[model samples]
Target: MHPQDSPSNRPTPVSADTREANRRQDHFGSREAIWLFGYGSLIWKADFAYRARRPALIEGYARRFWQGSHDHRGTPEAPGRVATLIHQPGSRCLGMAYLIGPEVLAPLDLREKNGYLRERVTLHFLDNDLADNDQPDVDDPLDDDGLTTARTAEGLVYIAGDANPAYLGDASDDSIAEQIAHAHGPSGPNSDYLLHLADALHAMGGEDDHVFGLATALRRRMRQAATHPATTD
Candidate 1:
């Protein structure tokens, strides 16, 4: 659910309303179609139209739950953490990419307006071999003019960098998970967002220690909350 659809106790949003900024920056130029990468909710709940979808990965980045959500997953008083990409050499993050027409950017910009700015990146589409394997082969593909070249494409991704007001920065997994366990907002419980993303990655044969670790921690907190309802209250 979008923040517009519900009553909000949220303060004037802390993050910049990036819809206008994103609209002005024609990152795709005159291209009719462009690839868009989804490493978070867009991976499972694509509320937009797309022509094609593929399992894809980006190099030199690691997904971290450092972005804060004041409108969707939690309130302004107690924001929920969400995933954002951090530059990390030798690291790769698996996600889904969509080939979409330029018109689709309008709604997406609004949905991710909370400090998220559109950034361009190179996407590596997974082949059948990589998809079927128990562990994805994340080695940087050879740059030869063959399969790697054919499977790679330039795309846009929404990123909430530390410069943004809603960036919570780094924290312990348990601390992040604890906040997720208690926070709720227009979209629902924040833990649901964490679990849904984890499930989506597992289905795609993706392995992310960071994501899976938080999921594990969140579940443990949930179980404890269930077992000791009075203590939780």
Candidate 2:
């Protein structure tokens, strides 16, 4: 179901006045803020032109590139694989923190529909003066508190899936690579997701070594395919 159709993500069925008030409150001002933690696609395709993307981390969630679903990502002919966050104890995953206007939530919610759910997480900007001072040049290391260590929010943010029976949390690198490469889009395969991510990370000059690690892995994988077409895909 679309995020708007999902009762959990929507405002309650209430009086018109109450609903209006709720909408007003949810409508964040230009400076009014919310933090979106991006680990996967959002890391690069954060369509929201954020006021500022601060380097911060939230604890408790470990990103596993395992989630598998035939409905949205895969097809009967060429099954695709994607990434989803998993609850892993005593562990941390690297990600980016986006402080954006509330207006962007609508599309973000919609993009993460069907199986995914949203849970709000409160992430601290490594620098309290978030926008002031020099923006960390791409790749500048900012400390992160994994899913367990960071503060959790009562409000909701979109999640990949919510207790989704179809959710599968583990997929092989080759599987993900093939899916990313083979993904059919009006313009191209979902491979652009990976390619853009590499480009974005490179553009941002991410100081985090982990992002570099994945970027390096993807580069090598793509190079391998280029060198030996028959072996790839």
Candidate 3:
């Protein structure tokens, strides 16, 4: 559910008529702050002037290198595939949060459109501090909400169709490594994306030790596979 449309929250829905009338003003309205949870490429290239940004921890959702994409980080001509969140046990992934105003959603909507559906995700967003004129150089940090419960946040969940395969359950580490090696996007290979993610997580001080071993193994496997392809019996 959109923040404006939550059960406890009551925001006047922008009707077709209102939206049409407000089209011109949509870009001109005084922006209200909204928060976005960045997990993948968004960590690096989410475009929006933020009021505050801090390291955050989200629960009940585990990041998986599963869902594939054909856009955003990819193009039609030799398109690249990517991953998304899937339910799992004892999983915690590190990601960033952006305190953006409502005006930014319009662009984000277009960017995350197509096959991706917006779902309400429950994440513990650290009410991080911002650098206002008053709090300049105040050493912004992640705020401890001290509460880990279900909260609604608009998130795009990826679905497969455009040259994508169905969920193959929990793939073995080797299988996932193989996929990353083969997958390619507009920028580069799937392994490159994973490496970038690992780098970003490290940059944000995200806690997840699984990726370390996974990345290291993928590199060695990719190297050996390049020299000796398995003979299909």
Candidate 4:
């Protein structure tokens, strides 16, 4: 972690007005089924129940570990790094879209506390096999060649802005990896989160340079630490 990036520097609390605004924009009114985009820990550690899930792609955003975690992954003294979306034109993020019910909103809101706010975005599901089930209507037109074309739909995603106090902004990959290598919080070791995300992406045949790079660095650091234990005179 950066020297000034102390978790004690608590992030500005999410005001009620901001929460209301986010809810007003992303809330599903009376909609039985809602779609949610999951790119980071949500991919493998989705604590909420869902109806179905499909591989999805979202454009105009990039997954980055620029957010500080003070609860699930760290504490008030040493915050752990976590993923947050940053707008980058032409960039696409691959993840999963979950079909969930309306009841999930409350718990999700609490879980994504701190600087994270829910934002609506268009998600393209690659699978065209939703015919067996009642899939939500998509705005994108289908291809005539009978090849499976991506279907587009609006979904809610959690994002933390750079202005947020919890935002770590830019840091060297080695520095970030070093922090993650030794951080642990209420949830568990921060390295577990990185490894899980990397493994999940690999299993889906997806490659995220940032995520994979950090994971590799963290592994190397861990190996070094294990091979040469620190001495205390």
Tens digits of lDDT, candidate 3, 97-180:
565556666666555543333344444554344312213223333223211111334332222222223222345556566655
Tens digit of per-residue lDDT, candidate 4, span 1-233: 45335443334243312344455564676566667999999889879987667788899999998887767777656777889999999899989888777778778777777677888889888776652264444532222321223477777898989877677677778888877776678989889999999999998788799999999999999899999999999
Return the TM-score for candidate 1, rounded to 2 decimals: 0.84
Model 3 whole-model lDDT (C-alpha atoms): 0.50
TM-scores of all predicted structures: 0.84, 0.59, 0.60, 0.83
Q: What is the lDDT of residue 137 in candidate 3?
A: 27
Clashing pairs in 4: none
lDDT for residue 122 in candidate 2, whole number 0-100: 53
Which model is ahead, 3 or 4, in terms of lDDT?
4
lDDT of 2 by residue, 8-70 (tens): 222221111122223334434443455677766777666666645555555676655444434
Stretches > 4 Å off in candidate 2: 1-32, 68-79, 128-156, 186-188, 198-221, 231-233
Q: lDDT tens string, model 1, 75-172? A: 88877778899999999999988777788999999899998999999999886533323231246232231332348888999998888878777778
User: Clashing residue pairs in candidate 1, if any?
Assistant: none
lDDT of every predicted structure (CA atoms): 0.81, 0.49, 0.50, 0.76
Our model 2 lands, by Cα RMSD against the true structure, at 10.8
Per-candidate clashes come to 0, 28, 3, 0
Model 1 residue runs over 4 Å out of place are: 1-13, 128-149, 231-233
Give the clashing residue pairs of candidate 3, or none. Answer: 34-100, 80-184, 80-185
Candidate 4: segments with Cα more than 4 A from true spot: 1-26, 130-150
